[model samples]
Target: MWIPPPVRAPIGGAPASDRRRVCARIDRLVSGGQRQGWPWPLPPSGPLGVGRSRVRPGALSVGMRRRRPGEPLEPGNAHQTVPPLPRRAPRPSFYWSDFNNVAREVREFCEENGLVDERRLPSATELRFMPHPRPWLANGIRRHGGWKRVAERLGVRTATDVLSQPADASAPKLRRRGGPQKPRHYWREWKNLRSELTKFVCENSDSARYMPTVDELEAHNRYDLRYAIGLHGGFRLVARQLGLVARSSLIMRWTDLTAVAAEVRRVAERARLPPDVMPNERQLRQYGPRGLVDGIKQHGGLSVMAPRLGLRSQRHYPLRRKPRLFWTRDEADRQLKAFIQQCGRVPRVSDFLDAKRNDLLTALYRLGGLRSALERVCAEMDIAAVQRQDGVKT
Candidate 1:
């Protein structure tokens, strides 16, 4: 009952020797298959050889050990699972211009259509984006002859549609040409005439009060006569008259007048006087004209009242009436001597007073009666010195 090799057996329906050989072959095939990394378990009907028989229709025993519940399975010698590849997006169509073809087509179209008449034909600039059917396709018919023709065609239809249908009818009309040139010379003449008229008006008017002298008038004209008059006269008729001008030319020269007016304003502002020396409304009402002392008292408050009262202006307070005394030259001299003896030295005078030596001396004499007093003191001192010398031992 020894079996032959699997190679000697037929595929199927073979003899016992063949069967034995098949069985031996199957064994050898299985062994070989295992070595070659194929699934095990040959079909019973097949010859015992590699790849000869199909296995059971059930889950094929791929020589892969079954994974236990919750157990990790070993990798088989099969192709790995791969993720599906991503799809690419389609590209957009682009249109490129062929200038040569376009130009040739345009020339041909112009020749064919008798559009060579410059006046009737469109300008080169207007022909931009002109379409040619031949370039697009030989038989492709272009609705527009060129850009101008297309525009014209569309414009007519668009205009018709607009006219037929109601819309916001207030859209502004299209201007066909550039606007008018600015009037430069007219403006220049107008300004010059205005200035000359302003001068004439200022000088010839008799109603002008405080007519500035020639120098004054020139100065005012240079700056602004109207403004000066306005500032000085405070809206006088003269100022108003100068400012008003009926002529366009005069009106144009108003800039010069304006400049003058500005200068006058500046001068007036600079010349403005300081606040009044009189008391404020509140103070005047509260104290009245005779309330100078009271007003001073109020301003000084109680803290400063004593010093203010002691001031020279307030000296009449203690004295019933201002004192007056008459003194002869000898009496004045004696008094001055007595005053010098009491005070020790004459008072120092100001530098300005010292510079006017005679005036300072006169002032000192008049104010203090020092001149006569000094004379009397000198006489007495001279007698005393002589007496003292006599008393001293020779």
Candidate 2:
């Protein structure tokens, strides 16, 4: 509040308030606010109010009074300088000079490391150690033409130079890292697998003990034979190699037709029919001609016997038409809708197939495509009941 008595002129001469207003206006004008027409609250009426004042144009109107005589300037006083503005980084350009420099550095690196004239190019691991601002040899080679052209331009030998030579050339071979690789099939393991299969066949050839159905094979704890068959070609070749039965026979064991013929003749003689004559197809389908049908049934079916006896299968017998075993279309759709309601979601085609209902597959396709049919079924299905049953929101 201690303004010099000269600055505090009472309401007429320049007061301290008028001096502050003038100084602020000058600062704004100097800082380029004049073009914006930013006006000062106090007009440029000089702090003197009427006469020409000592305040310089566009300068802060401070200390207009003359300094008293014989006062020395302070020692710590120094001129202030504005700090230099920071410079920006230069952007890169794809100029020939830059490309040439990149090429030269890469060529030198290749030559020094003995990679320039070799058949083998540097591995990714080796390339990682390339010097800074490396031009990344791989990227450079790809971008500036290719390896051959870049190398030719640089007067360096291309990687292809060594490769183009015959295999018998004097260039040393690239040794594999980590020593020799093991063979794919372990010889001892294969041998053991073959021995085990051979022993199994010899022991169980007469009995069907070792003959596994596809499902059984999948479920079995032993994977030896399966692995061997898969590793080698397949079942037939492996079985043939091991001197077992033919692959077809392995799938469905062949019947001894001569033994079957003897059994039929005995059954016929016991039934008091001519020893050579077999029962009619009708008789075979019925309670199976008493003893004969029951006996054949015991030994698989009359179908198996008919084949052995050099007769057509009784299965193909043109008897009275039986009722259709398959579900009708409406029945199938009903079942599907019922199932979807029960499960709370449409079932997959695989679900139908796995259900082993070939009829259902037929009916679904007949109604429409599987997805469309399921959509239709789902639309009709009682979703609310399904949700309630499943204890989840639909």
Local distance difference test values of all predictions, in order: 0.36, 0.48
Q: How far is candidate 2 from the true structure (C-alpha RMSD, Å)?
A: 32.4
- Please give the TM-score that candidate 2 achieves against the real structure: 0.20
Could you give me the TM-score of model 1 versus the true structure? Answer: 0.14
On TM-score, the leading prediction is: 2
State how far residue 252 of model 1 sits from its true place (Å).
67
Task: Evaluate residue 23 in candidate 1 and report its C-alpha lDDT on the 0 to 100 scale.
Answer: 50
TM-score of each: 0.14, 0.20
Which residue pairs clash in candidate 2?
A: none
- For 195-262, candidate 1 gives per-residue lDDT tens digits of 54356556764443333333344543433433344344433343344465222222222235334233
lDDT of model 2 at residue 307?
A: 54
